[model samples]
Target chain A: MSAAVPSMPGTRRFALLRHGRLLTGAILTGALVAVALLSLLWTPEVPTRLRILAKLKPPLSEGLLGTDQLGRDILSLLMVGTANSLSIAVAAVVLGAATGTLIGIVAAMRRGALDALLMRMMDAVFAFPPILSAMMLSALLGSGRLNATVAIGLFTVPVFARLARADTKRILRRDYILAARGAGKNAARIAVDHVLPNIAGAILVQVTIQLGLAILTESGLGFLGLSISPPAPSLGRMLADAQTYLTLAPWMALAPGITIALIVAGFNLLGDGLRDRLDVRRDVSA
Target chain B: MSPLLDIRGLSKRHPPRGFGRGAGVLALDDISLTVEAGSIHGLVGESGSGKSTLARIVMGFDRPDSGTVLLGGVDVQSASGEALTKVRRQMQMVFQDPGGSLDPRQRIWKTVAEPMGLLEPRLARLQRREKVDALLASVGLQPADGDRFPHEFSGGQRQRIAIARALSTNASLIIADEPTSALDLIVQAQVLNLLMDLQETRGLAILFISHDLAVVAALADTVSILHRGRIVETGRTGEVFARPQSAVTAALLEQDAVSLASTDQLKEKIHYPR
Candidate 1:
């Protein structure tokens, strides 16, 4: 866009927009979040208020994506659904990663019996499939977005904690870390200041990838009637509702299904591109 | 002042675990030395000759199995948190691998200011910055160079930054463990000159550890030649180089006596890989 910065031999920097997949993914993610936020402020139809007048109207004259069986504009429902779904996923991931990273750092720094115990506990948690774990928790807490968020968040914690612990353990052995210890820095300061910054890039890449998985998991719960309950405009629930009317109104299922696929694909692509960008081996010149 | 650093019976042996347990590798065997204040004492040896180990012991990083390292007569063997901090503040080390020694994520300024932050917490943030800038300038780097990361600098520049960091704290003793090994010959000379200048102006005692005889010859006032973890020879740098008593020392200077000493089995190649 302007003057080119001198790059190391063989390391070429790409513009953010040049990486089409990542750019597309980021744009889609942002749009989804914006729509979701807007849904909170206003929606064309009260997602639950059933009105027979506009029922099952097909695209164009009836407006975009037409109307569902409940006469809710499919476009409007999508806006609300994207917001509701992403918010829950984001909240769960934030909570999970924050708590998990703390546990991981503590385990890495303290080590010994406590570290072994915590690692084993994390392993036990990891053994459970994310969906199955979320299902059980949702069943226990009853079907709701909050329950889904909590279940997903708890599940996500062990994943990040294990990653953080492994990375932190390796970083602690580095010469600078030893220097910090020699300099009389306490374990906490060393862990927070030195250890955390080094491993944060890898952790962040993991977080982004996990975020995609989180969205899919939350939607799956909704599809299974274990999240956000009925009447809420969730893409998963929409797909479930459209199942009975597949032959009659295929677009009902198609729109939301496509949204889910795109969102997940975008996240995966973004994560992949970022991993490439942040790669220490990949020099910044060519 | 009773020698700035005194060592007595400093022996460290790595237990050859697995199959080699019975074959004890005496990394440092009864290595004792005294470093007078305001003197540049060089510990010269071949690789695996225990020069690095001695530096490590002096810094309190490794405890000798049965030895005493005294920093101004205070035994470092049992120094705890506060005492160790105090000892470290009084004595600092500059490592061989500047890239490895520094936190890559940290800026040059942060690395330089770290020791000061640990030792002199009472100094205000602005004062610390001023001191760090001064230290950087003193090491031939401009004040603005502190803003750059370690990866941004060349090998020689990084070594200089490491030296600046070591000098930032008011350390009486600086153990430079092959501080210029990664640099090119010219840069190495430049760094050596800087060290000499610093020693001359600051009156700082330096323990310059290196396997390079030529480099050591350039800087060390007194040289201690270690072999198999023992100080085989110790004297003025010039005297040791001119008339090496041991064949191991002679071979180290690339003299023809290397093969002659092999007959005794005690004059094994020092095995110092560059």
Candidate 2:
């Protein structure tokens, strides 16, 4: 029960280390989002308008990044593609994390038969990989951004469920939780007031990491021609289109490819940094 | 007048783990005790003596196999939903670990006001804050101390915060399970004195559970000595301490005497840095 007072100097140094990673990740992630938002206002040329005369122009030509096989500006396509990819990733992560966390909390609180059932069902969902599930849904629902989002989001349900369930179970065992119950607080009230607030740090770290994974999943589906149909300028679809013209136009493939990698890295770094900062026990030991 | 808290013929057995067919270990054996209004009934025993099991049952946290717990003559064991909650609000617990009892992430005021928030959901936030401040003051803590977290306080301060929380509901009965076992000797004395003061001022009935015979002897009026899920002896604290009938009670009193003598010697030799 004795509270361990962490040394201020040690904690301040650790904070600096964690902040370094967070800052880098934030900057990279911010720049990509800014590009995507800016694309909503203006791009060098219309992303889908094909000018046959300027086909396959290299970098620093008619547009900043050049033109694609159809003469649609590569820079414009990259920007618009980022917006599409980001929107899908954000929606999928939000949907998956929110629903999954709710299920997890319920499962942990109503432990025993209900807990076993919910967890087993989540295991069933976990069996299917994100891209495979997205492809199957795309086949049934037909290829579109909405279908892609649902598939990727559903795929992430088990991840959040497992994390949320474990964290909730741990919090449920804490003395304060028992005290809360003893104070006449019901299960639902305790779940909201006590359980959720304590586990939120872990859940947030999971969400950031999942955002990166969702983006990757959507892009993989698009690469396989099962996500966000052609002419709308998705990052994955652009990569797929560039496959045939790789030798003739490498930038067509490289532009979207590098952008996807940077964004994913950004999210991952941010998640790691957050996990370190928020969990004081881990922070002190490390 | 009926006792403020009454427990009768309560028995609980944990179901055998795994796929076994045998009966489980009996945690409590028809345990019965009562706390009269404005008095302290101490349940003293060694570890695994069913002290905590009885406490949990009295709080309605665990269901008893055979007995009924009556709070103000209401059968708490039979109550459900809102009825259970209503009965629960009349009785609260002060847990063993003071530091762990209060939420580390929450401010002292929020932790103190949590019970009131649950029981009186319609109370204004400002009003609740004022009430929490008053509760802190009652527990010998400054009103401004409510703004800090549990980690910012010493072990004794955290226990005071917990005592404030227990009093938040204006509960008639407070079940304190070894409330000061975790503190240093000086802090332990302070917390015990505070509990005694609160009991006198609030007319609060207390079920004080502990393994330490000396501490319980000092605070509790009536003492029940439990051994291996059964009450070995029960009587007024002074009579039992002076003339222990059961071997378990005699051994506990002897051990406590030895520990007290040794602690006195140690205290003289050791000076703890403040």
Give the proportion of true interface contacts each model preserves, from 0 to 1: 0.32, 0.43
Off by over 4 Å in 2: A1-15, A282-286, B81-86, B117-119, B262-274
Q: Which digits, one per residue and each the tens of the lDDT, describe model 1 over residues A1-286? A: 3336455332434553447656777887777777788889987766676667988878764657887787778888888888888988889998999989988999998999999999888888878876788788866887798888988888888989998999898777666775675566788888877888888887888788888888898888888877786777788898888888888888889889998887788788878877776767411110
Model 1: lDDT of residue B206:
94
Top DockQ model: 2
The alpha-carbon deviation from the true structure for residue A172 of candidate 1, after best TM-score superposition, in angstroms, is: 2.8
> How big an interface RMSD has model 2?
4.8
Residue B256, candidate 1: C-alpha displacement in angstroms: 9.5
Compared with the true structure, what per-residue lDDT tens digits does model 1 show for residues B87-145?
87888888888777788788888888888765777889788889999999999999999
CAPRI accuracy category, model 2: acceptable
What candidate 1 gets wrong by more than 4 Å, as runs, is A1-18, A281-286, B15-24, B255-274
Please compute and give the TM-score of the first chain of candidate 2 against the native first chain.
Answer: 0.92
